[model samples]
Target: MHDTSLYSSILGLSSQWHIANAVLDSKARSLRLDIAARSCAEFCCPVCGGAAVRVGADKGCWQHEDLLNMRFHISAVIPVTLCKTCGTNRISVPWERAGSCFRCMDNP
Candidate 1:
């Protein structure tokens, strides 16, 4: 597949999965990266659909490949929210699934 096709597929998959903005930046040391963020309001308890309050943040990073054989790093600030009604903590991510390595999945 062509580079554009590959990128398009990844973007499509991400959007289908409700993934947030997938930024492509070269300024940082990493060649390519996908960043995701979530807020307290986004958190929804698995047991209930109630909104959860911000409890804390979890910092994480993931590596992926770009269109031109460039390496991309995905950094995320995951939010942990506490549901008052359920008394449970909810984890929310602004991007798609964590383990999805688009670069690896898309072969040209």
Candidate 2:
């Protein structure tokens, strides 16, 4: 059985951002998600609060937890926006903590 709480949490987190969709693939054991927002003008720099330009593209993968003791992997095709003013590359996502998985309850 799937845990509704987990699904709700994922949906809530995605809602906080400009996410297009979030999917949990049990067969692939991965959460495939994407974010939808303006290409350059409206997007904000993830590192610094500055205007960003679409410089390149990248993907990130992390390990999370599912219902019960099952472990799930999450992959996001995040855009690599470069801040011309700050000269910093930014990726947008609701990351709970640095180097911490979303599903992990342990404090690092």
Candidate 3:
């Protein structure tokens, strides 16, 4: 059966985001999910204490743990911000480490 909630729960994803789509490659035995944020303006800038706007996203991907023989990955264009003081900046994802390209647990 097709299910995003199961994977979402496994990922411990925050309520602010949801899986937009899931791509399965049976031949490669892999799965990739595209996620989207519910809101963007709720967050503040890390560089400066300034109000920020959600500019868009920076498409990035992260490899995650496997489910049996199938590899799982999460991909998204990370939401960006246009801070009044910091100019333009990419907002951090909750699942990723500070300044790291991949997730906190995943090896890059």
Encode model 3's per-residue lDDT on 1-108: one tens digit a residue: 378897777666777678889988899999988887775335567578588888777777787555656877788767788898888888777657554333533335
lDDT of 2 at 10: 52
Q: Can you tell me which runs of candidate 1 are displaced by over 4 Å? A: 1-41, 66-68, 85-90, 94-99, 102-108
Candidate 1 lDDT (Cα, whole model)?
0.49
Tell me the tens digit of each residue's lDDT in model 1 across 11-77.
Answer: 4433312234445445653444333432324556645778766677666665565435566654555
Q: Which candidate is the best by lDDT?
A: 3
Which is the leading candidate under TM-score? 3
> Candidate 2 — which pairs collide?
none
Candidate 3: regions farther than 4 A off = 39-41, 48-50, 65-69, 98-108
lDDT of 2 by residue, 1-108 (tens): 333445446545443344445666667666644544334435568777777777776666555665335465444555677787677574655654555456422323
Cα TM-score per model? 0.47, 0.53, 0.68
Residue pairs clashing, model 3: none
- Which prediction has more favorable TM-score, 1 or 3? 3
User: What TM-score, to 2 decimals, does candidate 3 have?
Assistant: 0.68
The per-prediction CA RMSD against the true structure, in angstroms, equals 8.1, 6.2, 4.2
